[model samples]
Target: MPKSLSNSYSNNTQPPFMLLIPQEEWQSLHEKLDRLTDMVEKTQRDSSNCDWLESEEARRLLGISPKTWQNYRDQRLIPFSQIGRKIYVNQADIDNFLLRHRIGEHR
Candidate 1:
């Protein structure tokens, strides 16, 4: 572990890093980043994903009022979450409810 030997090893170690990239690969990376940026802006403007819906949104989707939704929640007929004072519902639960209570049996 002499200082000269250590210095030589450090100099020869190549910084443990790389910047290897073909022209096509760099273009592809740029394209991916641009698409990601566009998606982020679109999502910020209008999030259509059910995962982003709150309780009120979920109720609206069900064509019901907040009070009725609360009743359903209280009755445990629907799955929901309470974080502190905020209530939330899973879109899957809403879909499952519709399917389970739908009319007409299979042929």
Candidate 2:
């Protein structure tokens, strides 16, 4: 056996683990990660700001039947928008509708 192998066996010691990364490279990696995180957060905020639900989705969200949904629209009880022949409701509008209809004592 090699002397080095014999010595390692006798001492029951393994080679030291080392990770070599330059300080500049490490800082650059962190900066890139921060930028990526910021971009992801901004995208999420932008998407949440403009969430548009279709008729079926709006009905499901409000727990109403198709007929009831149509009634609400005819009565102008819910906020909605129409593009061509398709209808869309903003999530914020749905949230506002829910808040307005909430059954509780005023604080």
Candidate 3:
């Protein structure tokens, strides 16, 4: 059985750590964690042999809203990584995304 974090300390004024997650909230937390895990695995699997770009650079290159970029990742259209709250992506992934989505050609 897993130990509950609610009993961190009884003698300290500000116990090192304490968590009191309600049972109802566990499901929501579980779903969010599952999504995060999927994102992590996708990034890990594609982390080789490509130039990496920051989220800002990729968003600017694509000229799309942050939400759209997020949608792309959620839809498995791109692989990315999150480090300290910032996201990074491989240049080749972005290029392939564009090529797969090309709707016009230059003459």
Candidate 4:
């Protein structure tokens, strides 16, 4: 059975200096943690790579009314991130969004 963390404060005083983990389980856990760390790092890098436009600027770029922009954001039609109280939209995300929603039949 795996040792309990509470064993640290138990009357046993010395407590268990180390806990034993199975070799396979340890390797699997380490790999999973590494993958998670890589994903987080990649996300941070990508978020910082693009030029993020503030709400007003983004609305102007999209040629939409502030209300309309708010509507899209509230409906999740737009992708954005909030820093403190400010909202920022990634330029690439906006471009991709527009391209994805373009009309199929043009007049």
Predicted structure with the largest TM-score when compared to the true one: 2
- Evaluated with lDDT, which candidate comes out highest? 2
lDDT of 3 by residue, 1-59 (tens): 12455465454555355688998799899999999999998887777534789988999
lDDT of 4 by residue, 4-91 (tens): 6555465655644678999999999999999999999999898787678899999998899989998999998878999898999988
> How do these models rank on TM-score, best leading?
2, 4, 1, 3
Model 2 TM-score, all chains together: 0.54
**Model 1 TM-score?**
0.49
Per-candidate TM equals 0.49, 0.54, 0.48, 0.50
Query: How many backbone clashes can be found in candidate 2?
Result: 0
| Local accuracy by lDDT, each model | 0.81, 0.89, 0.84, 0.87
Clashing pairs in 4: none
What RMSD does each model have against the real structure? 6.7, 16.4, 15.7, 9.0
Candidate 3: residue pairs that collide: none
Q: Candidate 4 lDDT (Cα, whole model)?
A: 0.87
The alpha-carbon lDDT assigned to residue 12 of candidate 2 equals 65
Candidate 1: give the clashing pairs.
none
Which stretches of candidate 1 lie above 4 Å from their native place? 1-52, 105-107
Higher-ranked by lDDT: 3 or 4: 4
